[model samples]
Target chain A: MTPTLLGRIQTRWVLLWTIGLAWVLVVGPFLPLAGPSVGAVWLAGFRTLLIVSIVGTAWEFVYHGLQQLRWDKDWPTLFGLLVGLNEGAVAYVLLRNGLPLAIPGLTVAPFVWQFGTVWLVVWAVSNGPIRVLFPRWRFAGGRFW
Target chain B: MPRTLDPTDVPTVLGESDIARQGRRVLRRRFVTVGAGLGSLAMIHLWRLAGVADHALCAIGPLASPSDTYELLATNSQIPRHERLRSDSGSTIDAIWGWPGYALREAVEDSHPGSAIQALTEPVLHEFFTPKAGQVYRSVDREAARLGWSRVHQPGWVQMIRRAEGGGYWILAESLDDGPIAIAAEHVHVAIGYPGVQLLADLQQFRTDHPESGFRVANAYEAHGYIHDELLTRPSTVLVRGSGIVASRVLQRLLDDVEHNGAQTTVIHLFRTYVSDAQGDSPFFRRPAGNGFAYQPFNYPKSSWGGQLRARLETLDGEARAELIDGMGGTNTAPRRSWRRQLKRHEGRGTYRQMHGVVEKVVPTSDGVRTTIASADGTVATVDAAYVIDATGLQADPTTHPLYADLLARSGARRNPKGRLAVEPSFEVTGTRSGTGRLYASGAMTLGGHYAGVDSFLGLQYAALRIADDLAETGALPRIGPARSARGWLGWARNRRYDSNGVLA
Candidate 1:
């Protein structure tokens, strides 16, 4: 018997997507944008790193840091390349292909524009072990992460 | 962190990697039965009552039996010893049958003549009697023994359900003494019951701030016997939160203390939503208390189980259906005549008060606790209570359970509009079907989808019967026609065991 590739997603997938998106939303565009005019590529890449690393890490809490399943440095790196990048691209493609699905106040264009950018921001920033830099989370081979 | 192991090593001496053992420990096992297995408490009872506890089905969970936790709650709750359950008497744990029901059977067996009708009309006669929690326990345990429950019931904490490369699900579970037991089955029924309460944010913060509060503030499900021992005896004021059955029961318990011990129990009944005029406008023509609870007789209209209301619910989709659940939902009780009379007595005695407000904060005061409440009528008020009990219901969040967490994490399952599992009519979890291995679920975690009364006794039986029919249709089980049903009924009556699935035939 073999484990599904979905293993990387963590047991609480809802918490992963939910708490990740929620944390990103609550923090909003409040992270001081790095500089006067950050590169769009850097913005997207940075967000992907943050969303995946932070929220995704939170989801993996049961099997990681708190639990005995030690953090594997290669996990975020591998998942970033394998899952995050692909998810972002697919979400983008789906958003584009499904042209005009209208809601109450907004048109499809702005909706997709906002939705895609947020997803991209999530995709860019959510990478590995960034939380380890925070004073609180530094433990369990935190220096290595 | 899942591992890919050879089929031969399905986790050591799990079901059968090598030598055979007696009872639950097996030598070897394989299956092509349709919907080869089921999950949760519903599955446990099904195996026992269907007399298949020794056959194709085995209930594996962290409990010795399905109703272990539930029976404990029933006994512990302050509900009167003779009080009838809110569910219909005809609904039972017997998967294939609902015979003499609870009241009549108990009445006849106990030699309490004509008490059956009196039990149903209860409170009116000042003498209602549902089956005692003891009766239910004895019945289930009796059936369990007859059907060799311990022999087939795997007592273990399920860790994960990963897809087997050969198809079906590889269920990995750990027994405290026997280590990990991995069983490969075509179907898994997941019913991990309730996970108690995740107190509202403010209450949680209150607990965090006052680490030594002890039982002063706690969920209604957790025992707070101090109410009887210290608070009620000392003429204390209790801040009771929520408006559902638990709230009503707590209020009743307080009043009982007043009567028994002559304690001056001051009750501050707080409600987040109050229906002053319970028979509200636009009421469901056939249903009562659809506009919040003025104490509805039952949880949902009995029809919601499998009658006209259920059919209507099935026809609805998305927001409309969600709105129905919300409308019918809230702290509800049947407003039993005796409980209501007791409440009236207490209120007339000037010891009980009802208020509608959302608690904004709770800060410790010199004598007790000062609560900041924002009233429903655009007003803020302060109330003091020696003890605060959160009667808000169990935390129904599916993500709290590890198995559900694993399912959502991997198997593509999605929560419904109400934030519980979205399941099909067969109670099959929507996204867990792979090859012939289909997964089914029931109980509170699957409340809003197709089954409105998903947590009720009848709901468990209804879901099990529906799933069993689905399995039988797919050749996983034999259809219990009249003959088989009758024979199975007799086996149960005679305390003999015969597998309803024909697995042992």
Candidate 2:
């Protein structure tokens, strides 16, 4: 239950990053940008807050099972839903910033993008540092499936 | 809220902890049993803030199209006793055999104190009883007058609201009768019927939540009734679910329609359990006696004496009783003659089929509904039908009933796991201490609790008898003579009365 320094990053960092990125996509088009904007960037910021709250809550539950019931199966569902949401948010931010991206017609109003971000975060964190720093914490036998 | 501690603080008397006591109390009071434990859980969930908000939203929202007709209390109250029994025209259905005339007569003869009361009811009741279950309408005026029960003869929407304890209710009442003058008793017997019409409200909400998938998901009772009414107009294909009396009746209605109207309506039946035939031949293909087919009704010998044997077996332990029930069978097999005739007629006709499975989802096809039915083997088969009749079955979840919220709030009532009102063997709500106004319940609401089988007519009658006995124990039924001791005899007589005109009154 105790949180380590890096654990905090593992938990909170991606959530904030996903939200910050999603804000640029959802609000960029509507914001008062010099060339193309007519509305407020605040709209996107507000949406990012909502999307992040949903995505973060979902990821937290997956990374640490509800009340930390490790073997409980709800983690899979939580991971999947969050990862999908996170992916959409990433694509949206890339498109809004005019960065070269493979995703076509990127838009991120939906909360699905956060799902992907959380799913990846859980997979990486569970298998990465936690396994290396605390090998004992890793599930025994076959690679923490 | 913390559960009140046991009155007797003696450690020996306090057999259970506060939480366990609370759970048991809720179970006993709400009549929760193993079969219906989930319903009580759903009811508890409904009590949460989120649950209440969801229900409130449902109440104020525009109702979706009802899976079946919504029978309101006002319209039902207005239906005269005579007209309610038969179709609007009041003609007896001679087409179907075994009209229950003998049962109706037996019920009357058993009920009557003698000639006088018999004369008043026998003829009129006989006239009204018919094939359809709901049509047996009694004035309630007479029963109400005799029992001192208050009758709301013709209630409207406003009146129903008032009856629902103020306004803002969406429940459609078919009838509302208060038992003759209050016996100042603790228990109340509520018997509207299984899968009552009020369920339409819940169905409306379900359809609203899943609008894209909403198709013809009607209950067996309503669907069968509809088939009998508009046989020729039925869409080409139909899907019926659940393997119960209702399923059998629905098949009979469809087959009868094809026979009478020469229409081509394909019927597919669904069952949750796989029925293994001894000979691998459809039960319908075998003929039994003169004219009638020897269909092996489920629960076999027990179904023959379904009333007595079930009670006797339930007295045993779970494993023993399950063994007994297993020996009996879970689904009913139609009479050989009826199934044979229909089977032979529709064998190559491309009109009828029976399958055991469930629909995972229903998608609207351009021409009809494209349903994905998952069999027991995990095989998913797609069937396209112009209309989809759910006939799935009913849920006892208190959430399904409109009045549950009010009842729970006003009284510290908790639903049993079955989602119906839980009561003890004495039919008293658990957790309710003595002097809590004996609020007993009857009908399927108490199924899996003290009194099982509150769904069947025989079951209802048994429950009524039990309630009567309980009330008598408490000296509630002051007018009636000594309580009847022989439950089976009473049940037999009641069945006879329903049979007088081949229609149960």
Candidate 3:
């Protein structure tokens, strides 16, 4: 997708991802205070946890964001979430192959593959977490009990 | 604000003998008539909302007098005198403009200031301030009196509606007060609520098999006070078929009898597929309970009537609309906390028992109706109960109405994908648009039409308001400006009559 298309609106997942990355960067310097080798493994585990949380949270945003519209709260979206989970699996594989940042400068991929991997993460998060968390805001519609 | 009546349209004052039918009347000549209870109320509300003081509209239906229709539903449903309606306070049947709406009016009338304040501040409070069924009845009664309904309402059974010689349509009706009369009207709005709810097959079979037993079976629609009367005297078990609002209401009545009259009555709740958690997982729907009873807040979202959702529904095709309708369809009711608590108490006391099964057959027994049911776990058994209250809803098939069938045959009227009448966005029945005039249908009959909440109180209000605007656009009624609207609101507020047909008493 063109930057202009993505820039047109501040889609919820994109902002969530911005916050997530900012969090990781802020905490990255504190990893060594815990220990050396243990800290490295902990950082790897922390990154995986972030990926998982992002996957779970970002899918809703992607499903609604692709249509460039707000998600309808009443929509029975079990099928859509399943599809987002599938995309998250693919992102996890790409990250395993060292596409995304591994302690800042450790990506062993071509510029294009890295861009593709980042796009997939964005897509995954949008569909999963963002879509799940903030899909709708109508007060009168939806469940009463 | 009552209009000046023409000399030809003189009042028929019923003497002591005919006074029982107070709202019944005889009219020699009138330009048009739109019949039925809710439909007539809709027309009145529409005129008031638009601030149109008069029109050519008249109504001839079973609603003989003020509060007649309201009393029928409220009393039939066995709603206690002071009990609030199951729907939200926003759902109103009294006024069109709804300046204060139901909650505000009820709060004032019931003297519940906290409820009124809660309704104003916390919009999500479900049980904060709903109006009582009796209050609504009285409110409509007062409104009907003010609107000169006694003069305009002609008590009659509409046999059929056919095209007139040159223009408009002829309403063939046999008046209750006077004899057979015909009114040629430019527009006819049909709002017959429903044909009776069809009794279950097993009940029919049981009746046929054992004609001697004489145990009675009743549906929720009928005036089955005998069920309450019978239980009030002796101990009895009721096999209540169908799990909806009607079932709940029936149970409530039985419980009330048990509490006050020293009667012993048990409710047998039969279910087809008993989901363990009938309260569904979706945050968007107040789903039915595990006991096979609906517990939704209101019939539909507020947006279903006059908001963006309505506009969105209008944009979709018949198929898409039907799918959306299906998603929203099915039996549902408000989850009143008191009702839940009472039911829980009954369950603990062994007065209520739930079963998951479909009836294989029902045979007559010496004790009661012996019903053979097949359970979900492949178990089958036969049980007997004193009464069977079929709480299943009515059959709203458009073809069932003789007039609708005639309209379909004479005109090109058709059903939407949802098996209800297809209507234009203006609420005019799609195929019944004739020369310079139109035929409109409202309430449950217009279920598949542009509006989603067609059968709801607000839905009726919406249909009437839109139909009025559409009629005004076609030059059937006068244009309503700000001044006229304000006048109509004032008249309603002040308990003054502002007749839509421009006629006065």
Clashes of each: 31, 82, 27
| lDDT (10s digit) by residue, model 2, range B14-82 | 222432432321111111111111121111111110111211111111111110112232122222222
Instruction: DockQ for candidate 1, please give it.
Output: 0.01
Chain A (alone) TM-scores for all candidate structures: 0.32, 0.30, 0.31
Model 2 quality (TM-score): 0.44
Model 2 chain B poorest 10 in a row by lDDT:
B155-164
Tell me the RMSD of model 3 versus the true structure: 13.9
lDDT agreement with native, every candidate: 0.57, 0.36, 0.59
Per-residue CA lDDT of candidate 1, range B1-505, in tens?
1233243333322333221332233212222111112224445445443345345665665567556777556544564345556654445454335455676677788887665655444433433245566566666767666555556666666666656554567676565457656667777777667756557677778888887774467777776676667864577888888777887777778888788877787988888887655443532232243223465556764445543356557778788888766655545666566777787787787888878788888988766777899998899998898888888877888887666776776766889888888898888888877677777777788887976877877677667767776877888766645455556566665777545443332
TM-score for each candidate, following the candidate numbering: 0.69, 0.44, 0.70
Q: Just chain B of model 2: what TM-score?
A: 0.53
Candidate 3 lDDT by residue in tens digits, B159-196: 66655444566666677767666666667777766644
TM-score for chain B of all predictions: 0.87, 0.53, 0.87
Candidate 3 error regions (>4 Å): A1-145, B1-33, B48-55, B121-128, B208-215, B278-291, B499-505
Instruction: Looking at model 3 chain A, report the run of 10 residues with the lowest lDDT sum.
Output: A136-145
lDDT score, residue B37, model 3?
Answer: 81
The superposed Cα distance between candidate 2 and the true structure at residue B296, in angstroms, equals 6.7
